[model samples]
Target: MTLSEDRVGMDPITFCDASMNLTYLGVKVSPWLGVNISEVGSHLEQVLRRVGELRLKPFQKLTLINKFLIPHFVHQLVISIPSRALLRKLDTSIRAWVKEYLHLPASTSNGILYATNRDGGLGVPVLEDLVGRVALRAGVKYLLSEDPAIRAMATHSVLQGKLEKLADSLGVKWPCSLTDLKRVRKQQKSNILRAWAAQKVQGATVDIFKGDSVGNSFLRQPSLLKPTRFKTALQFRTDTAATRASLRRAKIVKPGEDTCRKCGETQETLGHVLNKCRSMHERIIKRHDDIVKILSSESLRQDQLTTEEAMLGLTGENLKPDLIVLSQEAVFVVDVTVCYEHKGFVGMARQNKIARYTELQRQLKSRFNVTHGEVIPVVIGSRGAMPAETIKGLKKIRLASKGLLKTLSLSALRGSLELYHSFMDR
Candidate 1:
């Protein structure tokens, strides 16, 4: 309602400038007072652009109305905007005066979002559109600093880094501004961007987490299905604490077992456990030999010998068998059960590990030309713990990893070596 005498007081003023500071409401503010109102209209338009950038909607301008403008500018004004018909009549009344006094642009002839006074319209300022955006920028900055849940992810480098890339892809040019508008000024040196990012993330929320292909592969105790099933596996490293610990603990041989059971002198290493541990599986080995003897006529040719001699080439650096050893017509891939006691490694992780072991087993099968058998996952702890990979694709044990083959449970029976010898003898 740009009546010459009515312009005064606060409200998201319909327009303000030149002689236009206080409206009918009781307030007075403005340096350009008494100046023609038409002169300041263009400046108000530029101010509205700043409002749009802040993303504030028009309605919220009601709160700041009287505070910034006249004391009662909008206090008596109806909250609703004037209808189109009323606006048209007002424009008709001002069109000639505006056209002669203000050099109104012609491009906006039929537009009120911006309009040309030359086309029978009042080139009034659009104040309602500008205030909200200014409010929005302020709101964004406040939310970033006040929220906690958002900070959890902001502190994590990987997730925060990824979100920055994602924000860029969305055309949100300055990543931090979208996430945290406070970062727009580039005021600090350390990662203020990261700290403010907490606020930005808190401003957005996700309704769901954990997808379909999550931790469905790993074998964890009680089996939680998150994506980090291989949590322990991921901790493995090239050196230092985690990797060294993993190497030391993920064993087929017992943790403290000493000398090679076959020959007292060769100090037992992880390699020795797979090949020369005498106390490891005496019963299983006996059973395996007996079965092999019964399965084929080539039993006698296989060696039926003492532990020390048969295990000569089983351990140490030189004794490493290639993948071929497991596939030999009569060889058994053996792993003393120690995997169960060390960690409650999830099933999905176990499944992956078993898969890898199976691949090595397959390679050995091709090389050794041996009758294939199952990969035996045995538990060698004193607690009598036995962990089995329950997943369908990884239901068996892996007798060899990297490359040491020992006797499979079913392959160690009495006469097993005799049976292998018999087949070879033929």
Candidate 2:
């Protein structure tokens, strides 16, 4: 008997007279039609539907997407290259689900959703970029395989073009050796993806890109009990919090009507409410004092600490810093200030604080008969952004930056949330 006839006799169902689609290991394979897009859509719809039925927080949903949904596409991606249009459609649907879960406005930037958590974003994975990474890694693996057939197939495949493009994008020369390509793949995998995300948010109005080095350790807190507060803080950091200014930008309010409802003197931006609003003066003082209390508890000795004492006698100016620490060798004047994170405001605040206390530093040294005195400005951003100045100041006082940053950020975010509601609910 012929080999075909023998195979047909051995498995009659497998050998058909007419060409037709077949399911092999749950993936639909056809002689003429290739991997069906409808199948992939159906799978995504089912997964997303199941996700919707679950009671999961926004962060948990993001974790599911990263850990489950993205991996679901990896096998298919490795089998065949999907079109970018399809990937974009899937991403849009997923982002819509995320927006609903987080109660975010449509005006919220997608970059903030896809950026790494350390970069002040929600750390949601981007489907398109994820696909590219998967494909590139798989392609590199096949190209470097020991099997001659796989190596030949990879050399002639479209993946070569992608590999060359990746090299060009990274400023590496094309037609690189196998060793060089493998080195690039190993070293630049995570960085290339992160760079893509960072580049996407470079032009964002709120500047959420925290860079690769400086991490927002607050996001890694282990507690999930305060998801609402976490959501509020996330919204505030991304500039999508329900402030009058954000409402105007989202077109939820009339144009040109974003003036501060409390103060009525300036536009009711987050900056205005958090730092400049007259009606919020009491709450602002409370926020400042709360930070003072934290610092006092962490860094101050009870016997040596002074709180808001008048310095007119020594400095000849009516200045009262937040806290004064009298040590045997040097006296430390620590003043705490929270300002908007944008447009060099934190640096400006730190400089102003130093200048304000320069004369007082000299006076304190003379009055206390200490060898040295320094003014430490604890400058925090209104949205919990820790500028380098804040880190330096915290280090100068021998405070643990991680715990303190988390505490300070939560305090600022809570205060901002209260201010937001106080104006909005009225």
Candidate 3:
């Protein structure tokens, strides 16, 4: 039949010869190869190679991963579902690159690499989970479309089986509608993935550390401005710092040599080097004084301030607290202590400081003619963990807690790093 005769009453149609692969809307599609997986891999390789040439710090590299690299893959992810195995391989490659760039050990937990920073991880998203999230979001959007044609197409799609399975796994009810699927996909699915990542770390037999109580506040505040210092502090907080103890755990050190080289008093853990080693006493005191100095400066701006000044009387016993601020309305007896982060020591140290100054609080209240008094304990962990009590204490003094917390955390972490180096050198 002639083309015009065939198309006389309808719009003209054109056909192209079939091929093994097709590129549509910026995505490659193949019946055999399926949806741009190979293209995505090649693209990632090129981008990562370019990225590696730059002298980026660990946090900067992490920023690039979260803000740039992941988003690059996510666009493809939303359009095409990659196999979990392939996504995991991609994740492994990215993680290895991260470790090399960050100078992290191969043994570092994948959870730590992928967990949110607020949850004590580096906050890099896992590729598999990212894909799952993207898929879930897209699936829900299609399944819940107000367009009846689109909705019906989705309902009968090959993806519907997979979507139903995912919904079931995510605790969404079967035979579900638009609203139910949307809620679970958007909110609960992401949380479940995060929890799963955290659980991987928590379930590990080694490298168990809680998320920083202050939620890694230093990164948000301008505390450890130097990238190297921030990296060191991050390593310390994540329990991946190359301390003698970790070296021994990694079997890089002789068992006997794991003892503190500076003091030879105990096994050279981060906690011991930061808090308990006798040889580190001077530096440790300086660390404590640095925090006290910050507090003292803030207190000086207020009504009346005292530092380690002995209080007379009280059954002939003299008391000297780290700081005392007396105002027209209240007296605050403040003591600063940096303790090992493990085993609830920060809390104990805080309570001890409060107890030690209880009688002094009474004395200051009466002597300073203030109507109210409190014993404030500024307790920070050696690895920069700050308890709520320290925050409360800072707030009571009208101090801007974010900057102070960052300063205190950096001081503690820097001191600990210095102590680690000093011990290692000896």
Error of 1 at 40 (Å): 51
TM-score, cand. 3 vs. native: 0.83
Per-model CA lDDT versus the true structure = 0.29, 0.68, 0.69
The alpha-carbon lDDT assigned to residue 152 of candidate 2 equals 87
Every candidate's CA RMSD:
28.1, 5.1, 5.1
Error of 3 at 114 (Å): 1.9
Residue-level lDDT tens digits of model 3 in 1-426: 123334535775332233455667667676565675676776887777778778866667767877888887777766776567777787877888887777777776665566555555666777776666556667767767899987786677567776666556556754565666567545643463355445332323112234553536655432344666666665665566766777887789988888877777788777787788898788889888888887787778664666678986457678788888876688888888888776556667877887777988898798878799999888777767766667777787786466666677777767777766676666
TM-score for each model: 0.17, 0.81, 0.83
Per-residue CA lDDT of model 1 for 312-380, tens digit only, reads: 222222322111122234443332222212234333334444443454455445555656644433322
- Using TM-score as the yardstick, the better of models 1 and 2 is 2
Model 3 gets an lDDT of 0.69
Weakest 10 consecutive residues of candidate 3 by summed lDDT: 200-209
Model 2 clash number = 0
- Ranking of all candidate structures by their TM-score, best first: 3, 2, 1
lDDT of 2 at 35: 60
The candidate that wins on lDDT is 3
lDDT tens digits by residue: candidate 2, 135-174 = 6666667767999999887787466776666556544554
